[model samples]
Target: MNFNFLDKLSPEYRNYKIERIKNGASKKLFFKISKGSDSFVCTDFNSDKLEYKNHLVVHRILSNIDISIPTLIEKNDDKLIIVSEDFGNLRYDKILKQQSIKDLLQYATDTLCIINKEINFNPTYTLPQYNIELFKNEIAELPQYYFSYNNIIDRIDSLNDEFFDIWIESFKQLNFNFKHFVHKDFNMNNLIFLPSREGHLKCGVIDYQNSFWGESSWDLFSLLEDSRIFFTDQYNAYFMNYFYSHSNQLISLKEFKLKYHLLNCSRQTRLLGRWVKLANELNQPWYLDFISTTKLRLQSSLAILQNNKLTKFYDKYIL
Candidate 1:
């Protein structure tokens, strides 16, 4: 598809030899420029005020912590261009598919440890407003979009009221002491793997606009329980132990287990609503593919909640 914004570039930017790389959501287009000595990336925004500002905030905040995010080169009212060290064509998703579990887990653990240490939590960021209430409201509204899929929609609809009530109650019951800047979408696709000087792998994070101050467990779950890639249970156990052993502030295994399940459910609930909305209202059918995976994760989390003494109340009310 021809991106309409490319033709509207300022005369100075139009001189560059532009190569369209790929198309992304929200009418964003990524391009590679050949005019400059160093290659740069140009992202065309679709006049979405919130989204544009969110991207700018991510760039500024992550860069301030010395994270290797792409540096902002320039921004017009509708476009934000950035330049930085490129990782060639190596993506973390590709690495996981081709590499061994041990190697991938090690890389992920080291990278997350670095990020956990460097991130500065900002109380003013609006992203963290995505709490349990927001999640419940989103799920409660999803049935409107999925109503056409009678059987699935009906099943989802049947649980909506109960789900939201229990979810909100559970959020209030749980301790929210855990606080850190979480990359809300911290999955392999948003990570770039580059070779380090010591001949090992290093990671660079990307697409951090949804970042917020929330439970660190959510980020850990996103890494270990990624929908695109599955980690072996044995490997997950080993990695979780590795993190607990190495961290200066130790997190108990039991606590980690509980938080992991809760965060997993929270994430899947949000994802389910998003997919339903995208497919039904936005006319994007591809998101439907995620339904099965989201259901699986939700069921697993519900099972864990049922087993926990603290969350067993969910069994009487929610399940």
Candidate 2:
């Protein structure tokens, strides 16, 4: 777990003290490097499966476009470690508690709209595409943790069948532009609030390198339907209205809601399995704490979407 390659690469960090940050679900490890008054976050991606380079590329693109992304200070390609400007431990949720949830949602909504407005579609960022099949495959893991593991589904095969069937029907509804910067992990925890900066830069974004090619609404839902915090009805309404109006009717509210609900269900369901995987495989039991809230959010979306396929599956296990 010693990721001192940053110190070896840069003499300034030779005296840096490394402290681990334990908030992420990914297998990659994060460390805080402290050298008296100077500080930077170092990420260690031990897994070759995860393309850490994508985040670095995104940092380059977003930084040039005026987005407040962490500035990449140093990186060692062979070590799979990256050192970037530390935004500190300030999270959007912490600000939400001190300020106003509704107010923060509006600011956050404005940030999302900026991505839609400013970031180009196929601007040669060269990131991966989040196609429908990739979306379906991610949702397919839900049955194991949400239904079968919970004893809601009787058979593994049946669980897989229901999981794919519901998602396939839901995926058909998305006639996305597939030409926007989609921050796949946009949420309170990953967002950093900086009061001193102006406009969207006031909100420094982290964990945004996991972005992809898709309709911008994918991120809007990721922000509003976040499972970490139970957003009030007012917060939800304000966010939807603000984004719809701000984007100049980019997508119809009706169609956006349809995509929003189903995408949230897909995301929440995928997260349920992700939490279980972290707890069981990674021995990170703290992930279990978020399961109930995530499940409730998933259920809420499923209830409203009213897909008979998912509705039947839900009643069988979740009810």
Candidate 3:
């Protein structure tokens, strides 16, 4: 529980105060370590939990690309803790309520532009490909958890078959480009607002160990169509246009829109099921509060995609 490694950095750290950060929906333990007015984050994980290694590798990758991320202070693998600079409590999720959407999304879109252009197909650290198999696996959570929770487990096998058939068919038709970098959870909660930083750097990203090579629109939808927050259709349209016009990607807006909606549906479906898993298995009922919001988002995405088969499936069973 103590950051013994910090003692070597400075004698004052020996008396630091530590408190748990109970925010993320992960197995990792994050603690805020304070020494007088200064503070750092201590990430504690078991040896089997090697996400810290991914964090370290991604920290290097993002840092090299000039993305704003917390500075790594120390790594004590023996003690299973990684210490890094603390960005305080200014997470973008909390800020969304107070700031204008235009102002807030500008910084977020700017950061996304950088990520789209800068990140390579194969970085120094190897990443798992976001292929069809992985996509199906993720959406399977809907039937496995959500259906089971709602007592719709009777025809789960046939339901899953229909569900995946619609998705796989739509996915193949999309022919999505999967070469770009996807900060898999690139949403408001993972961003820290740094007022002092300039331009896109003002958007500080964290908890990106789950980063992978995937469609750029996946992260776009992650930011715009966040499961935790609801943005009106008009606002979503304006920003999607803003990101497309500014980034200057070669894809047409129509194609981009389809990709965005498709991915958002996939994401929201996973989260819909995940809420049940979190409530029943993780003992986190608060996640269930977002179920309505997540369901609405999924429905919206499904509507946008205009897949009758998928829409009918949701109407009949999952929705």
Candidate 4:
């Protein structure tokens, strides 16, 4: 929120007017600086400089693979500030609201599939693998924030263990590991459509600093279950079918469907806790708005997985 840090960077930007871009959860600071119509986005990370370095590595990989992403302009390492190309205010969700949702989402879906098929994890570059403990901790927050206070921590922990157990079994059954590179936050909100570009290059990506080698289903789960976008049953089914058909088919169709539902439950579980944390810790009601939608998504996913016990547990607190 301070511009004094810019004084040491360049005399040209010292007189620039700063405007905050309130797009995401507000964990980090994003600003749009315009000095006589030439604008760029500056992200002030509340995290360490290593995250900035990760961004640089992943950004370059995505760029080399022909994925459309904002260009990095400059980096102020001492301040941990990253300046990158501004893709303007356009997001895939805003464009979807204009006309048919199915047509619009298909573009992003196909583009994402292309990215996954082409971008393999490079052993030489050393991208971190999103492992089990990290994933379990992500899911563990659900009870820690929402149900831990009512003497049900044990019950919640039991259910958490069940969730992990289910995924471990699925991992064995499908014979798949988390080797695919995933844009951890891949969704309509993080994508911008560039009509000037052709093919997969048409989709411009941002906010990919959290990317890691993770489950093949993780990013797709995030895409379809995005709380910010309304994916109708028809749109959802169409996209799911397209994904399965176009996928590398490393896993069977039936098993891939199972993985999809499991991943959905996993993500919605994390989001339920995230919403509670946002409201209780940060006093942000905006996240709480997704409660009902997230509940519905969890129920639908649980129905597919046929886990009535965990479904009942989730309903006990959330429904």
Better of 2 and 4 by lDDT: 2
- What digit string (tens of lDDT, one per residue) describes model 1 on residues 19-102? 776553445556666575756666655645666778877777767654446566667654554333445556777766676757
Candidate maximizing TM-score? 3
Off by over 4 Å in 4: 23-26, 148-174, 315-318
Count: clashes, candidate 2: 0
Estimate, for each residue in 81-186, the C-alpha lDDT of model 3 and write its tens digit. Answer: 6788898888888986777767777788888888877877785467777899999999999988888777797777888788888989988988787778888999
lDDT values for all models: 0.62, 0.75, 0.81, 0.73
Which has the greatest lDDT?
3
Q: List the RMSD of every prediction in angstroms.
A: 4.2, 2.5, 2.2, 2.8
Clash pairs, model 4 backbone:
none
CA RMSD (A), model 4: 2.8
Candidate 4 lDDT over 154-264, as tens digits, reads: 566676676567555554554446788889888778888777777667778888888888777777778778865555655676777788787665777777778788778
TM-scores of all predicted structures = 0.78, 0.89, 0.92, 0.87
Residue 195 in model 3: lDDT? 84
Residue 6 CA displacement from its true place in model 2, Å: 5.2
Of 2 and 3, the candidate ahead on lDDT is 3
Per-candidate count of clashing residue pairs (backbone under 3 Å): 0, 0, 0, 0
